[model samples]
Target: MGREDFERMARAGFIERNGTVVGDYDPRLLELLRAMDLAADLPELWDLFDLMKAVPLLVVRGEHSRLFSRETVATMKARHAAMEAVEVGGQGHAPFLETAGLPEKILEFAQRFASSVRAEAPSS
Candidate 1:
């Protein structure tokens, strides 16, 4: 499923023009390996979901990403009622890698979350 989507994106000129660099061959191998490494080498880091209880949580989603299902987002929102989810336009699973302007959206979300945190705190 993932491969098919990636192939489609490549054909649509989403990747590099040079075969290895972009729309040529299997480019998603690198991202897949990185995710695998994170899951395998830092299994404990996955538990950060619980640690989010002590900090502000912002959930960023790419509008087209199959990686995050609506049910998962709902569960996260239920877990952290204060959490905010923002979806970026014209993007898929790895928006940062696949689309432009996603970084700007991420920055904007961070800024908004920070301001909200400061606004809600009691005065010293």
Candidate 2:
């Protein structure tokens, strides 16, 4: 996003400023002028999602995330059966995991998966 775009989004309360996010963001399409600062190259990964369908998936989604839309979440669930998805209210992409009860829920999910995995026997 250019300076003008960031300024516009900030003015509209879409982007965060000073560590505070305004709730209830309506997803809007924006022109991609260039690659993200943190990303080197953006590769298509829908096939990867199909390839990993057998693996368990726990999706934490922001209700208003434009990048990861609700349709995407639904598509992921349709592609995978052993999937658990949690949507955070009034948040955008990569919602703050420190939000109420999120940390505990993540820990619980980890423990559940950890106990379910069987350890391989050592071949001494």
Candidate 3:
């Protein structure tokens, strides 16, 4: 959403009252925006998955995200047969990790992967 829309939402109590909306331009944020703008033209590196074939991959996408589409997730799964994917419901663009149970999911995934690794490790 744009700044104006975000401000309107904040005024209407849609966003948290404690949160600060950038009512004025911040110079530091401008630098961040400039960097993001420059990074936008970078080429997609989906093929980099080839190097991560041995790594445990977990792909979490917002259910309504335009950036990470279902097709992309499907292709990721097809390319990395072991990749696990999950979509957080009722979120757009990016999921709110604090409210989306993402931390718990990540912990579960890490624990499961760690267990598998331990099981496969040779006993000294």
Candidate 4:
């Protein structure tokens, strides 16, 4: 984004700036954006259940996010019975990871997953 845009976002509380320089756009990032636009129509994404069945899946979503709707989240939970989900209050599109309580919640989830794995492992 341009300097003006960044300044406006900072003023509006969308982001916090710590005197960091932020103007130049990366050519590689532009290329990746183009590639993502070209690959937007991904029908096979619905078949992720087969690949993710054995893995611990966590879906942390912003409550007001426009990209991932509530219906989609429900469908995902229906497809993957073991999926864990959490909604960050009063956030849209994306939640700032540095928000209070977010780190503690993630740590708790990780610890629970590790304990489950240890319990399932066969004794030597």
| Candidate 4 ranges beyond 4 A from true positions | 1-20, 23-27, 36-40
Task: Write model 2 residue lDDT over 26-122, tens digit each, in one string.
Answer: 4442234333554566787889889887666789998879999989888888888788899988777767677747999899988777766644344
Clashing pairs in 1: 16-22
Candidate 3 whole-model C-alpha lDDT, 0 to 1: 0.78
**Total clashing pairs for each candidate:** 1, 0, 0, 0
TM-score of 1: 0.48
Q: For candidate 1, write residues 1-124 as lDDT tens digits.
A: 3676667666666555445554444777778777675545445433567668767777767777899876778888777777777776656675553345556766887898789899999999
Q: What TM-score does candidate 3 reach?
A: 0.65
TM-score for each prediction?
0.48, 0.60, 0.65, 0.70
Q: How far is candidate 1 from the true structure (C-alpha RMSD, Å)?
A: 7.3
- Candidates 3 and 4 compared: the better one by TM-score is 4
Clashing pairs in 3: none
Top of the candidates by lDDT = 3
Q: Which sections of candidate 1 miss by over 4 Å? A: 1-47, 97-105, 112-124
Candidates 1 and 3, the one with greater TM-score: 3
Alpha-carbon deviation at 67 in model 1, angstroms? 1.4
Consecutive 10-residue window with the lowest summed lDDT within model 3: 8-17
lDDT: which is higher, 1 or 4? 4
lDDT values, one for every candidate: 0.69, 0.74, 0.78, 0.76
